[model samples]
Target chain A: MKKLLDIIVRIFRFIFFIFYYLKELVLSSLFIAYDIITPKDLMKPGIVEVPVDLKNDTAIIAFANLISMTPGSLSMDMNPEKTKIYIHAMYLHDKQEFVDKIKNELEKKIHQIFE
Target chain B: MIDWIAAFFLIAGSLFMLVAAIGVVKLSDVYMRMHAITKAASLGAILMLVAVSLLYVQWIVWIEALMVVVFVILTAPIASHMIAKAAHKTNMPKGPNYVMDELEGVDTDIPDKA
Candidate 1:
């Protein structure tokens, strides 16, 4: 029964991965398109650390990669001991909001996909 | 038509940038600040870069923009990881609002003192 459940979960995860990748591709393409047309120097890039709740390394790595692939940010560091991520961002406003965004949005998706 | 597109890109990018900056200022902890910097800033940059590419219509410029994107994609996470690790080693405090700590009590080995 446990093996059967594992198989089913794996299949579901595979399907989810496909969908996630597709979404990521579309979003990245759109971001690239947007990058091609605008003119302004409004970016205030900096590195900031994001605390992580998830314990798995694979999940953490995936989360970092996902953030990097997104438009305005890159995941620059991962402190394994601290369980935190350092990200270099071209834009930032409310740090707590950003943290919450990652925890609630990006990390949540990652946990669903990887867990 | 082109001008309008450029304007839109500029405005959108600026908005993203502004929001990212605000996040850095408003967030209470280092972890939260990192989140603001990575997501909003990356999106803002992509928007701004796209706008520039549209205006220039030059292959080299577009390629350069792509390179920047690539660099950002590659570096941001690595940096984040390093910083987080450093914080952990230094025993940085987690936010009070955090509810659960999955890493707690996972290992029982003691470190050898030099």
Candidate 2:
């Protein structure tokens, strides 16, 4: 019974993750569309270092891809130690806020799904 | 009514693709252009596929649409990541607004040829 319940929970979490990713995909595309249509120079591109907590290679790859697909951000490279990832953002108004948001939202959700 | 909804999605997807094209021309840097192409293009493709799946009643159409969406979503990030990494490796010039580069001087698998 416990094993069945665990499987059910995992499936539910996976479904939720897919919905969350879809939402992100739509919103981010809209945001980019708006940015492109406007004439103003609204972009402030920069590369910021995000510390990684997930150790598994599959998890890391998924996390990087999710980040890339999301709003204004792209995963560029990871350190040799695998402890940090370099992310390039088109509009990075605040570096610390960006790092914290990724950690709290994307990374946490990925951790739940993978682990 | 269903046709209207499908048309709306198709139009919206086309608009997104248009924006991506404009962005590629207007964006000042390689990284920013990659952002425009990868995210917007993939989402546009997915939306169109969704519209196709919605219009058709056949189960096979839905399955095919789902497969295409999966293929697009899976490949987009990997393609963007590879482009970004290559640009970084070759020391491609950044835009004027580029503020910070955390990856600078970090030795990875590829030696910085620039």
Candidate 3:
């Protein structure tokens, strides 16, 4: 049945995301402590606007939050229209590349599950 | 052997908490500090809970500890988001090293401080 296949696929994706997010969280937390432990030139901690396509409130909030727990990035605020989110990132090698990853990796997976 | 594993987790958890505490003091400004509190501290606490559950060696204790862990994982980020949002909205001071704050331009409703 198509419905059965959908449910099965969704469940697998759910498991995949849980592990993916957890792995990233633990690693990033270690990185944060490592940054503090060793004296390095601190990156300018500035906020960048991440353009978003997610409109559903729950998914949008989760998307914002998923980034926050990571080491160098924190979601500061969402725009009034939900079109963008402000993130305080420790580094920004290439903004467009970063945004593209968010869309391709995070937003797409989350959208499949919640939206 | 069980004790050894539990002790490792206990030590690990305590160390994370210690690092988090130090980070909170050493880190400047609110946004960075929030990172210390929620991420490091939460992980530390979760590890501690695991150690406690292991030390007690009881199913009920493990269940209860896991319940607490679940609650913590669910709430910590939400709490951090609230603080971050409020901090962003109210114009809290930023650290010296950070590059740019684009949010200042995006939020039109922020009243002129002068």
Candidate 4:
């Protein structure tokens, strides 16, 4: 019974990984395409340090990569001691809003994946 | 007509760049400075690239612009992570305004080879 349960969990994790990769692939491609075509300069990019709530290197690395892959932003630095992520964003309309976006959106997704 | 659009992109990109510089100067901490530089500067560069691509419309220019975008996207985060880890290991001071520290007590220091 234990062996069977382990296999089942493994299968579920594999499926989840596939789903995450697909999401990343689709989102990144679209970002690249839109960036190439858009004529208007919609980017109000800036770098901001985000305090990371997630623990573990895997979670942090995945979170950083996800941010980098997303449209209009890039992760430039991660302060592990401070648990902060420095992100360079192309569309920073408001500072607090940007922080909320990272914490609520991307970081949430990362927590789900890594934690 | 094309010139107008190109000029617009150029100006917008330059403005973003200026804002990024200001952010770097204005932000209180190292992490904040990194944030200001990366986001604003990347966008500014992208905008400039787009304007240039529109003006030239050459395959080579387009390719170069794409490369810049790709490189920035890939490396920016890695750089940030490295800096953050190093800072943490070195025990950099945080802003007094900082409320909570999740990384507190975490073993961020590197083990000596000796």
Per-residue lDDT of model 2, residues A15-93, tens digit only: 9988888888988998998899989886888999999999899899889989997898999998777889999988789
What TM-score would chain A of each candidate receive against the reference chain A? 0.79, 0.95, 0.88, 0.74
Question: Which model is ahead, 2 or 3, in terms of TM-score?
Answer: 2
Best by DockQ: 2
Give the range where candidate 1 chain A is weakest over 10 consecutive residues by summed lDDT. Answer: A32-41
Worst 10-residue lDDT window for candidate 3 chain B reads B104-113
Q: Which stretches of candidate 4 lie above 4 Å from their native place?
A: A1-62, A68-104, A107-115, B109-114
What's model 4's lDDT at B19? 68
Instruction: Quote the B-chain TM-score, candidate 2.
Output: 0.92
Docking class of 2: medium
Docking quality band of candidate 3, CAPRI definitions: medium
DockQ metric, candidate 4: 0.09
Q: Pick the winner on DockQ between candidates 1 and 3.
A: 3
Residue B98's C-alpha lDDT in candidate 2?
A: 79
Ranking under lDDT, best-scoring first?
2, 3, 4, 1
Candidate 3 segments exceeding 4 Å error: B108-114
* Model 1 alpha-carbon drift over 4 Å, by segment: A1-63, A67-115, B104-114
Q: How high is the TM-score of chain A in model 2?
A: 0.95
Alpha carbon RMSD to native, model 2: 2.7
What TM-score against the true fold does each predicted structure earn?
0.53, 0.95, 0.90, 0.56
True contacts recovered per prediction: 0.14, 0.79, 0.55, 0.14
lDDT of each: 0.64, 0.90, 0.80, 0.65
